[model samples]
Target: MDARGWDERYGQTELVWSSGPNATVAEQVSGLKPGTALDLGAGEGRNALWLAEQGWTVTAVDFSRVAMEKALAAADRRGIALEAVVADVTTYEPDRSYDLVLLAYLQLTWDQLGPVLRTAAAAVAPGGTFLLVSHDLTNLAEGVGGPQDPAVLQTPEQVAGALGGLRVETAERISRPVEKDGETRHAIDTLVRAAAP
Candidate 1:
């Protein structure tokens, strides 16, 4: 979906995603000390806000103005400060590097994702980390939630390969349990964490 489509969807609901940060993001970042961070495709700023609370100076970027507004409001309510910018990830060029560059559930086809991932990786400072989480390609067959379009889903290897010179720290497919109608099922996700040399 484009920014307008996302905006419409966000407008129809109070919150499109959970208020809390992604489990993978929280777990992976827990070991790292606070530093400057950049969150790409930051929808509602859940992860960005969480990072801010952890003492990281965060810049949240997203294409949807509506979503950014909601994120700003949420940040205000939490007494956390963050830089929120409305820009498409494909076209955005960071002015400076960050200690952490995060991309969560920013699903796109391999061809479309390559440039974005490279741009994100390029924004990472030396020894900094680039973390990404997205629906795995196998999610359509083995998962519960997330985009069903195969074109948008990617494998951990594909994500890792896009990071030109980053050292691969972790790249794997993981299953996450989701509850619906009192039943629990698993969703397949690709998690990739790389570091700049």
Candidate 2:
């Protein structure tokens, strides 16, 4: 969906996604020391806010104004500060390197995602981590709750292929359980964690 479409989806007053950080994000990032961080395609800034609460300086970038507004408002409510940037993540250029660069569930086709991932990887400082998580292409057949279109879905191979220089620490498909209609369903996700030299 385009930014306009996302704007409409986030126009409501209530939060659409969960207020807390994504489980995988908290799991992988909790071990690392807090530092300068950048969150690409940060919908509602959940992860960004969580990072700030952990003492990391965070910058949250997203194209949708409404989504960013909601995130900033939520930050205000929690007495946390974050750098909010409204811009297209696919082509955004960071002015400086970051200790941690994150891209969570920023679904896009290879034509769009390849460069975005490459650019984000390049923005990572030496010894820093670059973590990415997104709905896997196999989620449609073996999992639940993700984009039905395979064009936007990704795999570990696809993500690692885009990031050529970074040393990939972990690249695999991880399953997450979700509750729907009182039934537990699993969703598959591609997780890639790389380190910059």
Candidate 3:
């Protein structure tokens, strides 16, 4: 989707996404002490705000103004400081690198995602980590709760393919289940954790 599309979605009353960090993100990184962190494509800044509460200096970037506003409000309510940026993640260029860079559930087609991942991975400080999660390509057939568009879902191999030069610590497909319309639906996700060389 383009910036205008995202802006429209976020303009609606309720947040499209939840107000908590992704389950996979919290499970994977909660043990680590917070530091400088960046949340790319941070719609509503849930993860970014959580990071700030954990003591990280957080930068949250998204294309939607309404989302940024809500994210700022959430941070204010929590008594945490969060820097919200109104910019497309596809083209955002950070002033400095971060200790942890998060790209959770950013469903983008290859044409849009390649350069962004490159820039995002490059924005990780040396010895720092770059973590990414997305709807698995197989999720179109096996998963739930994500865009049905096939072009946007990517596989672990695809993620590892684009994020070259980093040592991949973990890359795999994960299963998730959700109840929708009173029915249980299974979903798959691609998870990647890499360290900057």
Candidate 4:
């Protein structure tokens, strides 16, 4: 969806996503030492806020103004600070490097995804990490929740290829149980963590 479409959706509801961070984000980052972080497509700023709470200086970027506002308010309510930037990830350029760059479920077409992934990788400082978690392409047939469009779905291999210069720490498809309509089902996800050498 375009930025305006996302903004309209966020306007329709008080919260589009859960107030908590994504499960993969919490699991992967909890053990790491806090540092500068950039959260691309930071929908409601849940992950960004959580990183800030963990003592990381976070920059939350999203294309939707509505989402950015909500994210900022969430930070304020939590008595934490976060930098909010409203811009398309495909075009937005980072001014400096970060210790950690997060791209949580920022699904896009192959044409768009490549550029954003490259940009995100370029923003990672030496020895820093560039982590991505997204709905796997197989999720269409095996998973319960997530966008149904195949154009936006990606695989771990595809993401790894996009991040050319980074050393891949983890690149695999994993399953997670998702609760929907009082039923539990497994959702396939692509998790990639690449470190800049």
Query: Which regions in candidate 2 have their CA more than 4 angstroms from the true location?
Result: none
For residues 35-116, could you state the per-residue lDDT of candidate 3 as single tens digits? Answer: 8999999998878988898899999999888889989999999999999999988889999999899998887889989999
Candidate 3 residue pairs in clash (backbone atoms < 3 Å) = 143-187, 144-187
How do the predictions measure up, each by TM-score? 0.98, 0.98, 0.95, 0.98
Question: Deviation in angstroms for 147 in model 1?
Answer: 1.0
Candidate 3 RMSD to the real structure: 1.3
Candidate 2 positional error at 33, Å? 0.5
Tens-place lDDT per residue, model 1, 126-188, is 989999988999999978889978999999888888899999999999998899779998999
Candidate 4 on 1-197: residue-level lDDT in tens? Answer: 89999999999988989888888999999878899999999998889999999999999999999999999998999999999999989899999999999999998999999999999999999989999999999999988789999999999999999997999999999998999989888999999999999
Off by over 4 Å in 3: none
lDDT (CA) per prediction = 0.93, 0.94, 0.88, 0.94
Q: After superposition, how far is residue 155 of candidate 1 from its true place, in Å?
A: 0.5
| Candidate 2 residue-wise lDDT, 1-197, digit = tens | 89999999999657878899999999999999999999999989999999999999999999999999999999999999999999999889999999999999998898999999989999999999999999999999999998999999999998997887899999999999999889998999999999998
